[model samples]
Target chain A: MEALYHVAPFTGYIYPNESVVPWTVLIVIYPYLTGLVAGAFTMSSLYQVFGMQRFKPVAHFAMLTSLCCMLIVPLPLLLHLGHAERALNPMITPHTTSAFAVFGYAAGFYVVLLLLENWFVFRPHIVQQAQQRKGLLGLFYRVLTLGSYDLSEKAMSYDRKWIFALAVVGIPGAHGLHGYVGFVFGSLKSREWWSSDLMPPIFLFSAIISGVSLLIVLYALSCKLRKVPIDLDCVKGMAYTLWGFMMFALMLEAVEFASLMYRGREGIEMILEYVKGPLVIPFWTVQLGICSLLPVLLLSFMIWQGTKGKTLIVGVVTCAMLVLVGVLMMRWNVVIGGQEISKTGKGLLTYHMPWVEQESGLTAAILLMAPFVLLAVAVRLFPPWEDGKAAH
Target chain B: MENKVEKLEEDGRRKFLRLFGAAIGGGGMAIAANSLLPEAAATETPAKAAIPAIPGYDWSQHHWAFGVDATKCIGCLRCVEACKVENNVAKDPNHFRTWVERYVTLEGEEKARIDSQQDPVNIAAAGAEGKYRFANRYKDAKVEKAFFVPKLCNHCTHPACVQVCPTGATYKTDDGVVVIDHTYCIGCQYCVQACPYGARFFNEEKRVTDKCTWCYHRITKGLNPACVEVCPVSARVFGDRNDKQSPISIFLRNNRVTVLKPESGNAPNVFYVGIDKEVG
Candidate 1:
């Protein structure tokens, strides 16, 4: 008989003494970056897709979020590896044979859309803002446009198409970028927890949920802070979108559980235990209850005939909760939940977050907070909704 | 124990000298496992020059191999310590070239508690009053059987690390060995994800990626891999897969050896004579 002693152990969980293997660090960075992408693009789509003239106020906020989020997409995957420096080898000499790689186009392609969309949509307004402000702010606006001060009808038309076309292309690119992340997990055959076919859909749906929810929350905050009137009807419309996407997101999560539970596949039962245990609170409190169900209830109530301002208020609050809970629970389900199963479907692996693991909770929190700081700077420069007086 | 050491030393010196003698043997035997031209062609024409030949290292001439008896693994830190000293792996929280993982499973079922125990001590530090089983400090957990797998780069014949290096910074040696040309690495981190075994790691200090190199520096001088040399139970084996007469060859012929994650298709050169199915 063949004995087990010929090879050392192989499992994903990092032992306490061995601090180098960072599962949590990689997981947090993944969702945080994806959240921003979802947040920015969904914000843009509200103005373009649903055609809410009022939500058009923060269209630029969508653009800025997309750019900032895309900037840090590579950092998480880089830090996840044993050899971060050798990361370039695959990009430079791509192995067509290995399917896991080949995401080289994700960065340059998305950046082009961002730069174009920014130029097309915001240039004229930035120039006008600069003209009004005589100090360094005006010079900054002029430089932002590279000195093309054209305000002709032709320019306005061109800007709309640029916004429309990029928005169209970016949706698929956004799907591809985030879907590729699902591909990263889906490709790994070592862990059955990540091997589900539903990973791509779940990730994509969650991205939309996180994305749209962020827009609702951030836009409401921006308007309230500025003492400006919010487009209540526009928010009600977004609530519909949020509710629709949330239904699918919740359905997908159920499907993921049902499939794994139905067959009781190798470690699926144990994984369910972790999800229903270590991840139970996050899953129920943040993901299922607050992130998913609460938003649905709010939107459903509005659909059954509620006032615009009330629906808007409920919609914004629901979105904020979804944003906080959706991304957090998704991360825990992946990183912590995956480690709780045995390779042989025999027993369980236990993991608890200690105070100072390299990529501990605090580290993740700091990285997550950085985008808000960046977003604040961007909002000040190009407020999504300009005062109506400028329209005249 | 003293008698065993004395008896083993009788033919040791000259045999040890010849181990490297064969290391410099060079030429006539290399396995270009990732030729990618089609396996049938390789089977038909076995005489093709798989390797163009390099000084002191030749895959065609590779004859040394590695072996391990899992039952004997006491989870000592000797091999890990030796690899660190030999390679100068950084002591940062993010760097690791070679390390030991303890896989603690439930008694009857293969329920696994897998984690890295960075520094492993002898049986004493395992902290048990009466049991023969080893205890992992993370949970002070005990199990029926604890398997310790010392993981490093497998040095595959078709290494994804070299295959993905955009700058040609990583390449397989003339001896059918894979190596990273560190100076050329741009640190984009693509190879880090491409590895099926999760073998390649990013080195922030050097701003490059690193993994096990089959102990190229020592292997060139006819010495065994640090892990192999330091293992008390001879659990890690290294040799030329092409040499049908080598001990690694005999073991492969006699045992049901396996590679980690054959589905990955990298065709790793490092083969375990008796690896479990759950690992890959």
Candidate 2:
């Protein structure tokens, strides 16, 4: 018979109940997906709100990415819950003091904002397709038109105004939603690893970098699939954004870690031991060294050399892919790593992730990929490419 | 220690609860007023309604506390077994409501070596996951100092677990016991992560977070907690501090007790005596 729970193996003297780790890899994916949504929205805002012409090509696509990612953000949490049906209890009678209680409202509000923004942005396309096409696909577009076929200059301007307003509101909405996720971990005074004032900002900065990086990769992939030329200027703009934010993310993380060590509180010794022994590969090697530092250096060199065309696209995409991995590792370090060091302050435990189970590594991998699947189908329906007919 | 101070604390807690209740009520009203459905206001809220009413228990009339005398603990494992049986806790080495830790400082060693009944060697000695025993691994070594300390939920005055519970399913009663309404808990385990003492754990069987409730059912029925009742050496102490003559009250008065992780600011209700500096 299968065991009811996975018991983490440990050393030293952890409280006996500490043997079973509470949050799993699924929890790690929760913040990662939310960060992507926030980050991608940041990219779209660069074009829609900030009026950065270079970002115009990918701005609509970024919004679509944010919406798709936001739609799937609740899955990991739902799957991790023991009674997923009762998940709305937090929203129904939210405990005002609890950080986790705000999630339902925050996520719900952001989803509505994203949906509204996407509708305004795509209404022109829906009207055009509704008039021109036939059969089931045409009916789908027609129904989506919401009974208004006005493509007048006045209506287009009205739609643009709504798009700009929603994007403006979404700046704080998206970032606040992700920052709140960081607060969920940071405000916990229990574990020395997560308790930090710097957590929210750090998560915010990392989210920006990860989202920009994701946009770079997705844009490049889409161009390849469509046999269109990759926009070097657009990719460069996103690369610069990624480079700038990655520095802030790296510095905040370093400062947080240094402060934790310098404070040298009661559990400092055990934390230091864990970092040197168990945290070597995950923290120092992947998160900091290869993924973070290497990407920053590569992007810097590309910018300095005035790199252009395929070389620049390859460089920017490479850095973006590395950053995506780096942010995921950061989430893993914050979520799973916090648990590995027991609250006892005298012990450490190793979380052995299950390969295939309800909340297993496989489930987490699938959840992470699910947004892209939706994004693919959504991009087909909406067609966010610049070469496609512009709605506004 | 005085009734006046206790009254002030209780009053303060009541004020906070009143404010919290008002905030929820006000928010619910606003939501209902904005909602399209007229019947939305009539839908029952799950959290406040879920608190089970005990027939004879007056929770507000008493202040409960627990005490652990480390010096008196013999590591007999009786309290551990009794707790599991009485509470129907999972019969496994990992899931324990109460367990004893043996801290042994060998001669010339700077730190004490610690292990509980869950240690693999001890489980091997006991011959089963459900059983409990402390392995005699240090018998050959020259021991300088050794002692056993029993551990359980502190039922903290400012419980991190209760504060972090999203659904307010876990809450502190007026009598000072932290209890969970299993029916309302969403099973997110945020409380389990928030607890600094590792007191909380996700009950896979129940599909909700679980911990030592100080045997709320037994205490309300005028019986000692199962572990306290089964403790052969009187290491585990339990009673209402409202009665000055109660075991916990007298125990607190007699001992220079300290709590685990005072820096965590949880202000744990569990008092410990004869514990070493490294006990936490």
Candidate 3:
């Protein structure tokens, strides 16, 4: 492990320290997961703030998923730090010029908003749980209620008003949440790959695509598990939303790439080579071709022709899954591809993720899956469904 | 009367021995532990700062910069070795506070084939005279222009590394040297990514970001850094640029020099004579 830091297999002139890429798969996962939270929160607003009736059934569930994902966004960052214990230092004493200094505050504010909004929206259920359940579970529900057992009509209206207000605030908070991730990379003037004005919008839209996709897929799966009919209207609505955002994200990315080529930035050729070489298959095949183009085509066709029954369900599910993969690929390209170019314009470098379980490929894979575990725990606790059916 | 007196004397001796033992055990242990504390705390003691404080030394008055005469560099790797030894830099090929790169560009090519050997230089070839060949593997290839450029922290006036440090762990001193506060560095490597010169590295042993400080300790003591001291050809020079009589100031005035990657707009303080466009 120690040897890897110093003995970088570089092809050309790179600073000795620049030889080994510092940010790893863990950093990649950081933005990827946070983007999901941002996207999910925005998708929930489709019903809450926008009053899209079809999105109503899964709005609360979207909030739950977003919150769950948001909770785990900092896990990768914490793990990546050499001194994980001092993670609070940035929050405690933020350097004003540093873009990353805003992370702790942004994340804290967003999480608090999500918690408050979620609690108010689910207060009725909490009161019921507090009264109906027995022993530790009932005690836990009572504690979660925070001493408010009001089940009156007036109180419910007030909760609704607060929920509405919080949802309005959450729209920009969602953008701020993940847009800041883009700023962390974009603000870096050193790396040509990440230093761009369009990074925030690109990150934000892609985040929406991933979040909406995850919710659509999960909502469909939950309905299936409960032996209930699929919410075709809801699924189609999300698919359309996903399609619009994914198209915007893809377009912005294309513009960024085109400008890089036209302007002939310092490391443009190195990045082009990166896309052509080791990244060829993944960049073109999985990320752009299969995941992006395929889903865009499928979703567009579904929205235009209005397919019925199984075909529509299959298309929406498949497109959602592809978008999820596409977003992850985008993150991989941004975080890892940015490091491929050497600071010395003369050459390029490569990085291979290690298989070691602690801080390597397997560990990143496990960390990516960690949100789902939390989601499961949250489902057991709060029940994101209105039917009171368990989320399988 | 004799027995009582003898008993009283014995009791006094026992009391004295107990006090002596306690003092030796407790006080001696405390003194030893204090000495063994990490250098961070030890450097804070008044004794450590008493290194003949240079007369009239104030950070505000001094603006430091580095100079390199690329034409005179023999690529002996002495500077690289000296820097690592002096700063306790991790002996990693990829982790260097200072290093020498030998650039060889063929005719009619805009790009140069550059190679850097940061490992200890091998000078002990038996039967060989004083003339020593460098670790340049491309010696046999078609040579057009080849010269060695030693690189170190530029101590930029507007250091990107210091700008991106989340906790201000890295900062530019009033004296114009960019340095990392290892005690406060979170080892996030944002500064590493932000540094255009690739001067920053994560020291695995220390678990903190490390960079060339232009030998902050030695500079304050009115001494040359280990690298400058060990350079056989006096190719590397570092001093206050404000000092009109300093070698760096004289060299800057006399030589046609360029800062690496002037396009970066980092305003690097390290000026190089005979630096090629191909060199970073």
Candidate 4:
């Protein structure tokens, strides 16, 4: 006797097993990653396209981090789905069922835009230098340039126009990526903690901080390792930007809490249960203490000293930790924190990250590390600094 | 002679290896295919065949639209066992087919226990103290009006899972059952997390979420849902909510029934009578 039968195919788009809580976790995490990509890229453009002198040296690192995080941006989302293979259909053949389809668009579009923008901006110098090196090194640059090796005066000018246009186009795509992510959570009518009017803006601000912090750290590390001179102005400039964005993100989160608590609605109890008890550690320790505060402190010290090597080292360490802790907390809070409340509102929901989960703890950590590994590899290969005047 | 023996031995070794590999590979493939393509032979018979759900598939109308005369329940666990078999829900403690929730409320001089699992079935809490101390099946109210209300998926009309699915891997059947396409599902747990009812489960082994599915297997075969069929008191009701003359339509007309999260706009198809305010 037949015990079971295969269910519907593509037509069965709803999750058969969904209870109320887990769905909210997914919508929140995806946007957080996209916001980081957008925020970081925007900082890069401030120097490269807008001609901010202090931000000039920070451009290459910004571009590199953006590339790193952008490629793996969809990892958490893909991990949550029980059927990973079917994850691609939204990207492959998009059918707009809901606003969520916008994520599908942002994912495909940004990969190309980032690659092209980075190529046009970096190609001329890369190709020129690659031509000087012989054998495999030269061949690597040649292949990278893809036969577009004209480094003439007009060619460089044309490259600038391309970068400007790509950056302009990228601004909206970046917003869409983060906005779409915010929309995922905001649209849910269920769970009060998730339903918020200010979600998207909060996402954007935090993402930018994550981005600039990544550059501050990366720039310092590159300088120290390569024994190059420190660029105080660039570090300070990015720090200022990071500080401004972090304040905004923190304020927005506060406002969200304020608005929800002001109503003292039925769901407020659930939110308080999370903010006070189980979530106190991750929220206060990692998010407030490590991710935001320590970096802000170091960056402030660097800003005050405004000196050469010392400022760079402090800023570098601070930036590295902020980028790592800030974003990781953002992911953790959204995924686990949102589910901390039960629909009953009588108690809390439980989620201990089990090993066998598709997005198991270890795999998630590795996916997040992909950016640094790629950055290290990119630096060894491309060396984003100018000839001998590398900024440590 | 030595060369010939060597060649013969090598050939023998190769054949043995080939047979061994084939056996292992064939066995593995069978297990893999079984999970991917579940068996349907039993469901193909005339009387037992799974029926294709027709549109206007309102679950509120199913013959098993659960209704409890709250006075009868005494916190037994029989219904939970009956439900697991009907749904083939995982018995792996992590998965629950049905569980009795017994609640006690004390107000001033009034004290009462409301265990939804009826007097005949509350195995887990049989010997425990409650309103109906000497009851198994609800013959009459024992202590100051304790009520029982069975809970399951509210099988929504505008299910959030159907809305958030990226790959169209989730959809509502014409009969209104929310079905999952495991093959097309990317194991993305979005739908699993999105469902407010927590009626969803990620079939961790298959990497696709699976949940109550309302026993679509039995329904199409013109049988009641697993929980409905096993009730000794004939309390479960199933019918076409869209059909004016259906039993559900008559039941709803005669009784006061309510749905979960009426504001969620998911349009739950499950209806409850003799309700609890905190059912959501």
Give the per-residue Cα lDDT of candidate 2 at B17. 39
- In what order do the candidates fall by DockQ, top score first? 2, 3, 4, 1
Q: Evaluate residue B118 in candidate 4 and report its C-alpha lDDT on the 0 to 100 scale.
A: 27
Question: Over 4 Å off in model 4, which ranges?
Answer: A1-33, A92-95, A129-137, A293-324, A354-358, A387-392, B1-79, B97-100, B107-145
lDDT of 3 by residue, A26-48 (tens): 99999999998988898888889
lDDT of 1 by residue, A1-392 (tens): 32111112323453222222325455657755775686568768767765767566666677777776676666666654445666665555543333333544455556666766776677777878767877788788877765455577975785677578678767776776676667556544446676678887887777877776777787677767777777676576666767787788779879987887887865566566665666667667776777667767766776777656655586566665665567667867675565455433434555555334444556566666667777777666755555542210
Count clashing residue pairs per candidate.
51, 0, 0, 56
Residue-level lDDT of model 4, residues B1-280, one tens digit each, is: 9757755774675466346535543433332232222112111112113344455444434433334433345444456566666656654323444444554444433433443332233424345322112244434434334454555666566677766665556666656666766666666665655667656665645767676666777676666677666656545566666666766677788878778678767777777666566545
Model 3: lDDT of residue B273? 92
Query: Candidate 2 — which residues are off by over 4 angstroms?
Result: A389-392, B1-51
Could you tell me the fnat of model 2? 0.70
i-RMSD values for every candidate model: 14.6, 9.6, 14.7, 15.4
Q: Chain A TM-scores, one per candidate?
A: 0.84, 0.98, 0.97, 0.85
Per-candidate local distance difference test: 0.60, 0.88, 0.79, 0.61
Model 4: lDDT of residue B140: 47
Itemize residue pairs with steric clashes in candidate 3. Answer: none
DockQ scores of all models, one per candidate: 0.08, 0.31, 0.25, 0.15
Q: Give the candidate number with the greatest TM-score.
A: 2
| lDDT of model 3 at position A249 | 92
